[model samples]
Target chain A: MSTTVEMVRRPSSGAEQAPPSGALGRLRWAVVDGWVMTGRNMRHVIRSPEEIVLYFSLPIMFVLVFGYVFGSGMAVPGDGSYREFLLPGVFVMTMLYGLGATASQIAVDTGRGVVDRFRSLPMARSALLTGRAGADLLRALLELTVLVVCGLLVGWRWRNGVGDALAAVGLILLLRLAFTWLGILLGLLVPNPDTVSVIVFPFAFPLTALSNVFVAPELLPDWLGAIAAWNPLSATVAAARELFGNPGTGGESWAAQHALLLAVGWPVLLIAVLAPLAVRRYQRLSR
Target chain B: MTDETSAVVARGLRKTYGRTTALDGFDLTVPRGTVCGLLGPNGAGKTTALRVLTTLLRFDAGHARVAGHDVTRRPERVRAAIGLTGQYAAVDETLSGRQNLVLFGRLRHLPARMVRQRSDELLDQFGLTDVAGRSAATYSGGMRRRLDLAASLITTPEVLFLDEPTTGLDPRSRNGLWDAIRTLVTGGTTVLLTTQYLEEADQLADRISVVDAGRVVAEGTPAELKTRFGADRIELVVRHAGQLPAAAGLVERVTGGQVHVDRETRRLSAPVADRITALADLLRALQDASIAVEDVVLRRPTLDEAFLNITGHGASERTEVAA
Candidate 1:
């Protein structure tokens, strides 16, 4: 066994210096470390093309199956294609589904002792959580890009032009960011990746099903429609549909009328409520 | 009690998980440039103490200073000075060996150029140069552990903690890790290792702290602990089975100790305080009686025996009261 005598004998120079102190220095290091961690996660996605394919297939399958198999039977509340009405919901649903990946990845890291190793290092405390959020957002961007092309191929054009369309994409990402924080929290709370996988579906299915992701909220019974319209996932889906100039934007409920406000408000609120709790849980992981 | 001479020091450290106490008044002191093994059974608080000292876990009360910085108040400083290889191989399995080292070096704030250079050097040193590009998931158990250790040494920390570093490894891999640890200590890095294997403690540690029920039950050098627990024993096998009784009587008369005679094996055994003199007299007495001896040996108590004597239980037995 060759010893690490060379490592000890060499002059460490700047490498041995203490991490910079103070708020600004800390924030700067946090960004640097978080980026490094993000790069690691991105590499995982790149190396495992099958994982990317698996995630992308879900959204693409929804687009094809809903657009072709069920298009003739389904009805839109407004004068637009059923494919158009369904595409926005599918985009938002894909983002919601991403919650499982984020949660399971974090849970795997924690269960496998990777997070403990990070915690023992001198890097910024928030780097792991922030890195997860950043990587998931980037991944959500890729998924959206692919889904957008798929939607365009299926005759689901955004009639609201470029600016409103960009806003719609932004709302979908915002919802993804909020769900990212929720995923981080759940990942930290859950014991392992298998448990996260088991629980995320039961939690996410009801969320997407009860929302306006599929049927227009107005089509459901009065009591059920109220719950579906107010669902957080519904807000983003409705907002995205309105922004894209797609059909199924009609509803008398305050939530549907204020979809744009709720789209932004719900995400911001979820982030505000979940981010700090996740951070606190990470800091108190040993307890 | 932070001091330059002590790499790790703990005084009355206490931690509880609701109703269960994980660390109750745990105390230790590891001098710089030496290996201190925290030897214990399962659920014996060894890992908890290691976590607390490494700044991965917070203790409820008392104090700890690691690498001359207060553990609770100056955890970042402690973290900066220390490297910890947890019981599990914590290397990123998705990453190649070189990438794992580079990532850790970058996290430690090394310059990009330095990170690359250091990672290459580590890969070469650990004999992973051939497989440096392969993902750690494809590496064997020993290779992954070597990568884990290499990752921890990215910054050549002043203090390193290994929590059962060879827990699940085969003997060959375990020996390889032991040799690596020996080389590291020779390079002057202070190491505090926790292990349930008494042989591991004896092989690696300069000082061993026997832990039981969340506290240090005994602390000493391996030899010192062995001698403290029991005396050396002299055993001889008689060539003639009929001479076993004669040898036993002569052994007791010469050594002034009770002799255990095994007629089937024609063996006589007795514990001796003055090992050398007792052995010499026993051999002379047996020769005088014309009782030929086939084999003779002196055996000191093993660390396993010392641990059992100190903890009042075998090292592998889990104590119910320990949380």
Candidate 2:
């Protein structure tokens, strides 16, 4: 069992006082340290494919139910396919659900005291958030792939060329990245998984319901439609639809006309606002 | 090892959570390569002192240093030198035991090859080689605590902070952990362990600090603390249950101390000032009184009674309730 060898070769490396280096060195260390943690998180995802499948199934269910069951009643801009119109909306919904993925994982880690262990180490303080963001991005990409395949199987195709299709995919990923920060903020604020799940739904429901995710904003009352047009989720969905060359096209609203710019701007703003908020919450955890 | 050098030093540490104080003027000093047990009840601030020294929590007013690094001014240096195995086993349940160790090694900035080698050695040292590939969730309570301790030792930290590390382990596991800890201390690792278990402190600490109400009530070697509290006791169980009252009266008359008797067990026990004279007099008295004694013994004061005497309260009753 090599137990004797283990006893014989005990670590002789006494605490070699590592001097606090300059800011640049610390920043460099944070990147490498974060990448190492990202590898650990990826290993978890690979070992548990069932969890990944579960995450994918929920979004696929929404696509099937909304595209087939609710398709007949929903109005489209023209004779363009309703399945295609629902594709972008379903993808945005999937990202919204992905928000819970981060919250639940962080809550579990906090409850399990893994965060305390991480805090004790000499590694970068920001590595925890960076690692979580990296893994969540990977998960978001996987969810995007599965949803795209489901869309194709249901007769929803990206009519645009490969370049535009990639752009739309990028837009969806960007929105997911933005929500990841929100997930982190919520996770740090609420340490219970059940409470995080409960809180996420209320925010997610209103954000998705009030936007152009499931249906055209024109179908709502004028005031509600105006509000929906400016909702960040609406920008991403509209931009993705336009890029994918789907049924829905640009609308008269300024946000809808410049959907691509708004799509990029919204996530950037969300990241700017929530990233620091999450980091501050994390720093205050031990205090 | 110099007289002037202490692995961990804290003075006048103060901390509060809103209105309630977690630490108040708590002072401690542990010489290098020694195990200083912070013995206290549930809310007596043992954990708080450990947290402050480990750089996990900030103190409101105090000067604390870990491995010669001021915790508040040079926290990174303190963090680099210390290791902490908290009350709860801090490990990922989904990850395999070996994976958890490797991840921590990598985070400590160990070289890639060294990370793998050290992880293997730790797994083996903790007697987890066979189950290294298994998820930590599948491990027994003892195995999990060992893994947690192993993770903290990835870099051979100078000052290891153990905050109730054996709180929930079975007897066998607790002993195994204690052995592992002893080996580390022998290898020159300074340790600060906090525990509510008097037996744990008595068995492991070179010096024990009895903490109460966020401060140190008493500090001394285990033997010294026991001696300072009170003298040893003489206990006797009569051969016949009916002779209990007679034995109790005889013991009180001989020792001139309060005798406590259990009527059901026919057992009587009382404190004795001088061990040899008291034992001799008690035995001669029992014989003169024609009392048939089943058993007689003399024992020193336990850390439990000493702790109760010092703090005026028993240690946390959580473990007792669990038992």
What would the per-residue lDDT of candidate 2 be over residues A1-287, giving only the tens digit for each residue? 12223335545444332544998888888898889878888888987989878988898899888998998788887668788899999998899888887998877876677788898888888888889888999988888888889988999888889999999989999999899999988998898988998889988999898998877887788889899999999999999999999977777789889999999999999999999999988888668
Residue A199 error, candidate 2, Å = 2.9
For candidate 2, what is the lDDT? 0.86
lDDT at position B218, candidate 2: 98
Pick by TM-score: which candidate is best?
1
lDDT of 2 by residue, B230-283 (tens): 569999989988778888888998788999988877889999888889889889
Estimate, for each residue in A127-178, the C-alpha lDDT of model 1 and write its tens digit.
9889889999999999999999999888988888999999999999999999
Candidate 2 Cα errors over 4 Å, as ranges: A1-20, B1-4, B234-298, B317-323
What's the fnat for candidate 1, on a 0 to 1 scale? 0.58
Two-chain DockQ for each candidate model: 0.57, 0.43
All candidates: TM-score: 0.93, 0.90
Q: Give the least accurate 10-residue stretch of model 2 chain A, judged by summed lDDT.
A: A1-10
